[model samples]
Target: MLAARASDDGALADAATGQSEGGVRWAAFRQGLVTNVLNPKSIVFLVALLPQFLTDRSTWADKSVLGAVTVLMVFVWFCAVSLAVGAFQRVFRRPGARRALNIATGLVLIALALVIVLTG
Candidate 1:
């Protein structure tokens, strides 16, 4: 049976059960979690944007609820994106599709880097 592997990393999904070899790829999950948590935009949002909705009248409970909701929404968004990508695994496996995706992602990353350099 053909199984799915996310990358050169040992993250594998069984063909029959559609589960990872062991379970959740904790390493990858941790890496992504840390990356997202430390992202400048996320930091800015948390420091600046999140406080915009708060007032002197707001309490710790309100702040906690808002933070929890933000976390939940981000989790849901990432889960949806992961599922969508998994659904198109076969398409992504195609050489043409893979190459196109790689090129597009590379270009975007390069552009982002250039922007950061110029802005900084």
Candidate 2:
């Protein structure tokens, strides 16, 4: 919802300014948050992974604290990634730069996926 609104608002603003494409400054950050929160598989993985370090006698407060810390870590990491990507946007703005970036990123993703598939 926030992403759609941001995109629409950005598009309108850009159009008024004669800019063809809209900037995703805030939209990308919101997208990272939404993707992290909406992923059920990630939640399940977190639940399964976190409990391995917890004993049966561990209190709810302990789990809550651990979860909060984990979430904080995720927030920090996402912010760092978003900032880095945003900083690189200027370099990718040239003609054919975005296409090259897309191809490179796609290849990296495919390679990572293949590694995961083969390892898992």
Candidate 3:
């Protein structure tokens, strides 16, 4: 958002960034950090699952391998998503595109809810 705001030229990006560009970046990081740090499920998973992987001297290597694979997967996923989104961004910005997209998403979610409820 901060990067986009700096490139806004007082256009759409400016509107999205609000009054100050710097504030949004820090706020986003803070929100993510707080949510992650405070999540009990995260704590429980770290305590319960991670310890099993640390059973021996080779644990460090196991953790390193897992972390490396996770980082690589995330990088690959983001790259793919970035390319796909970049390609579709222009289409998304067209008039009434957001409204149509939102309605389509809502319908799909409603349909999924109905299916779940009916199945149960």
The sequence of per-residue lDDT tens digits that candidate 3 reaches over residues 1-120 is 212322323234435767466675467557756886698996787678656656567666788887677557656875697689769977776545655666688788889889999999
lDDT of model 2, residue 120? 100
Candidate 1 lDDT by residue in tens digits, 84-113? 987997888676676667668878888988
Task: Identify the candidate with maximal lDDT.
Answer: 1
Q: Could you report the Cα RMSD, in angstroms, for every candidate shown?
A: 6.8, 7.6, 8.0
Give candidate 3 misplaced runs (Cα > 4 Å).
1-12, 16-58
Native RMSD of candidate 2 (Å): 7.6
As for candidate 3, its clashing pairs are none
lDDT of 2 by residue, 13-64 (tens): 4446554453544554567679979999999999789988789999999988
Give candidate 2's whole-model lDDT.
0.70
Q: Model 1 lDDT vs. the true structure?
A: 0.76
Q: Tell how far residue 57 is off in model 1, in angstroms.
A: 0.8
lDDT (C-alpha, whole model) for all candidates: 0.76, 0.70, 0.65
